[model samples]
Target: MSPEQRLASLLAMHGENELVEFKEAKNQYAFDKLGKYFSALSNEANLCGQSRAWLVLGVKDDRTVVGTQFRTKTADLMSLKKEIADKVTHRLTFIAIHEVAHPQGRVLLFEIPAAPQGLPIAWDGHYFGRDGESLGALNIEEIERIRLQNRADDWSAVTLPEASLEDLDPEAIEQARKSFARKNPRLIAELEAWDTPTFLNKAKLTINGKITRTAILLLGLPEAAHWLNPSSATISWILKDRDGLERDYQHFSCPLLLSVDEVFHKIRNLKYRYLVEGTLFPEEVEQYDPYIIREALNNAIAHQDYTLGGKISLVEFEDDRLCFSNEGGFIPGSIESVIHADAPETRYRNRFLADAMVNLNMIDTIGSGIRKMFQIQRNRFFPLPEYRLNERRVQVTIIGRVLDQAYARKLAACPELSLDDIMLLDRVQKQQPITDQQARHLKKRGLIEGRKPNYYISAELAEQSGDKAEYIRYRAFDDQHYKQMIIECLEKFKTARRSDIDRLLLDKLPDVLDANQKHHKVKNLMQSLKNQGLIENDGRIWRLSNP
Candidate 1:
């Protein structure tokens, strides 16, 4: 199908929105301007509840089929796509680009994908918004709304009125004290002086010495979980084979502080050996860090969305990845924001309950749980923890070993790379979209190459990538060079027939037209090119506007 036809089909499929536009490209199309458009359209699309927005080339402001001659060479055009993708956060890239041929000429089509949940796509470190037809900076209120929209539940603070001190297991309470003492050594002295009720109260696990849902979750006996009401509290730990098939599963009851140890004991923590260059001996490592496991289990117990009637799940896959999925959306902000700020926000789903867990030292009050997870993984040379926040839930997956040697080496080689940089690169390795700024940053660091069809590699990674020859074959074209070519061609072909124009320009153009559609193709190309100020038409004659 032609680019124009495909765009029409896409528009019909998506329906009308303030975000999508069919522009004639009549004025010079600046890359920076396009970047602003991306931010505006993406944000507008999200606010308007649309999945995507389009910037269709070769159409006039009035939706007229002016036909485009915007001769964006295939490689040069791809650079535009890469430029946008690399700059955005999460490495968000276009879904696809389509070129269409019409009787008047050729058209270029850009399909921009929607931003991920809770994460708005920004251009060059700032977000853009559309106020009616005019694009401007995104307002703070809009940003807050986007952030808040994803959160559905906060399970930590829910009151269990019927739950009392008796609901907690005595064994669990003693275990909690030991764990708390281990985490807060300074508290050990004070902890010994306080009675169980006072300690529990101080820990925020109980209100006025009465049991709370936090107490039940952290130290409640398995049988007492039912007494908490509305939902039963449980944690299921599963051991899976290398293929991700479950081999064994065990369920732990609430008053989870003590039961966490029972779950931890099920996983084997053997010594692992790694080759250290220039050394005769291999480096010995633990299979999984004890602190990480404790943190993961405690985090699950503390942040679970019990209102969903879902139990916190810890799944250990054979592929050496540990996944913990709780029943709630992530708190409204980037994981980086939470870590870097090192302060809990005022708004929390379960403020009171989280306070109790913090006092007990089961969870950090500063909202550094995720940051700590990243630090631990980095220290262990493991892939960073991956946090997936959807509309309904938050899933965190931590890989125990290096999945890509090249990626690991790249990270190892660059000790100066910040945690945020590492997180962005990890997303790239996982084939997730990133912003244009992020793409440029990675390119600058020599960790990745190409523009749109980009790939990450250490020097060793390029060798292991297997398709080295193919990577070299798809070299991106220089935009300035291609633009110059378009100008020169239009100058030389003054008054050239449509057929002649197509013959001169077809090969280098974007892949938006069929081999047989040369007549319609030339018409669209001249139209778009003229609009972009690359060429000017004097009745039947065409020439470069400035040159």
Candidate 2:
């Protein structure tokens, strides 16, 4: 193991309260705490002159090491790392996780690196400091000191002084007014009495009758878009085949609110059909929900990182998934926070621009856009919208229809499943790790089987899919299982030949394996099993090495 990993393992073995510190996993842990811990550990590592710090999981207070069996697979752990990097300052990441096998059980060792010089991490706009053994809020002076280290202006709110009313597109403005009326029917009378300038002001498009960059972005004429220096004020919609090769591309000019419909018109929303649950009759649904498309487009216009000089992009794939990505990261901590909570804590990258969008009815003010997207996907039996955040951008993917009917039907049969449950199941289908809670739900429904590191379609889901044996064979060889199988084969056969093992186990392998590639798989399995200390292999044969 590396030094950082060794340090973390040593800390965990000693006990959290005795070596490291312990704090309640509340809001910061509950909401923003991960970011805080990342920053605090990063800074503390610098102060102590240590290469790394430890964030040991499954421990309690008073130096007591109450081992936590809160098992998270490798992929789940990586997801956590990605989430923290996406939200934290400067995209700092954990060095490594060392899983130490202590006498008590397994202890997870999180190796956090020191903060970079002149840069401190901020979690959801707040900074934290370690006070003795407890974590307390950072003081104003320290916070200010950290803030001064990074100086970047908000680009979306910048005023376009040279642009005038003549630069605004009349057609786009008229369409914006109509959309506003549609969103708020009660404001129709008041809206009709107002003139163009008054409407623009009421819509929050313009500030005190002066044209802003937001206004030009949403409704600027082609020439006006050209006048906005540095970045092009256009939204590009691209349709790609399965290979990610662009088949078609189109650009739309501002005001984006009015042009959103025009952009939608460019997409081919054909009808998709699937069989009914009890009957063979096909049920047809719209390829994509109109409201979801509008919400996605509006969100892109509202939250875009215009300062980065990147255009908003909408990419459609042959798999019936639409990916909407902008040049900004999610201001809220996560997609889960947006869906679970009824009202989100007000936070925005482009405050003025977002407010303008709210007034124009382009986006919802109550922060229900994401929740609504989830609800729509659920109602349609389609995959829930997937949100991915990288260093400087957020991507939202909305799948149009159920690609796998067997999986969809199995999911639909379990009506008691929560959004979280469905999300976990989706992850499972995507070969991602399901949380402990999700694993329990799936087991309770008899839809999934296996313990940690061993999971597959349960007998119930397999029966529903009309292929019990096939499903079992596919999910039979989890990492641990495969390793164990190799050991068992060697013990039984004394000195098992590679071909002999392949003949015995290849038939029971998962569907992901091709019939033609069975020999290659056997070779790979032997290598993996040998590496895990479960078996030993010479050039020609293999035998059991460890119990």
Candidate 3:
């Protein structure tokens, strides 16, 4: 069938839905907005189990072929693919751009390939998906569904026949032996008795002494990295000034077993001092916990998608934050899920790499590493680790210094609170979103106030945190207090304009409200006084009922 015929059939049968989007670029359409539609439509196609989705230009919402003048030139239209490819993850471009000459005018059908299984397509580092006709940020559930589509493939297990012991760094192999010995303390004598090949085989770095990608990634010589083809075991450490300019940089290749330390040492990690607050004395500790540093670096290596040919990045900021990023989407779907998972993740992108790392005492398979990072930060009264995940990469930011000392002190004092509770309250302090289930849990504990996604620490938390003044601002005055103010104003003036009542209560309303919300709230308060017969309004002026 002709392309236009197929589009007509789809419109007649399916109309506008998750898999089909119609746009009337009568004159033109936004480039950025079009990119967002690409991400959303592609993700929706994956969820719907379709091979492709349609972005039909020159069509209005009424299914009329109104025609689009957008990028009518053949070359101009062709350049859009490269423009989009530059910004999107994986450089996913259109499968085909068909310009159909309809009876009305020129109609373009851009065939968008469905997001690849296990990788949701991202536009400009953000995931988008459709909810029927609406386009918005892809929800967590949908993102996870797309990511878990194919979980069985393990790329690190692929064996490289040409690689040998000579290609492996001798020092890294010895370091691995020591790490293995530490992990298997009971097998020290036996471990020493085993030859290097035996140790490599037993350590799962190779498949029956056949060097696998995991071996080359962890213990291979720096030059041996080329054996992995496009993939490289390269870790880049960048030191950035407060203004975000690169001040110093270094890259470590292969023997990731030893390079992890080199990257760690490059970080400033200066001694951080918790300032005196209330009765608590100042205490000093390393800005970054040693465990956090190793766990983050090791996790990045273990979870990195070496197939992407991208170097693992460790960006150290002078502003007391460090960001570690690797080429791969977070497999657990969300960091919160990992931090709260009751059981370990059942799948890994690099199962062989993970198993080998476990044998080398590099990481645990139980998935408690991420959770422990959070606890360590909470115990130190620092902001919890922040994770930024997208289809292209998993980035984690660790803050070294205290952002809210009173809040930290209050949390430190609360020995009865569980780690989960402290984490939620920490989210509130950070102004991050919490799940509805989490919101209810915190509300049940009376630890937060206000609405979903906008919750503030409750008076209990604020009062205990030594910030009652701020809490009062968020808590606002009682309705009766505002009502009495209205009554006093009316009695004084015999009558008052709605603006006067608004002026009295707008500033006094909870700071949680936006300007529009504050104004709406004042209107509601005046309405209540009128309903209570304490005052009346002539749709313009309000006065005491008796007056």
lDDT string for model 2 (326-372, tens) is: 98776654676455443533456777788777767777767677888
Encode model 1's per-residue lDDT on 317-383: one tens digit a residue: 8777788888766644356545544444435556666676666666776656667778877766678
Worst 10 residues of 2 by lDDT: 22-31
Q: How many clashes (backbone atoms < 3 Å, residues ≥3 apart in a chain or on different chains) does model 2 have?
A: 12
Give the poorly placed runs of model 3, Cα more than 4 Å off: 1-153, 275-280, 435-437, 451-453, 478-547
**What's the TM for model 2?**
0.69
The candidate maximizing TM-score is 2
lDDT of 3: 0.84
Q: lDDT per residue, candidate 3, 335-386, as tens digits?
A: 6445544345556788899999999999986768989998899888899998
Error of 3 at 268 (Å): 0.8
Report the error of model 1 at residue 208, Å.
2.4
Q: Identify the leading candidate in terms of lDDT.
A: 3
RMSD of 3: 15.3
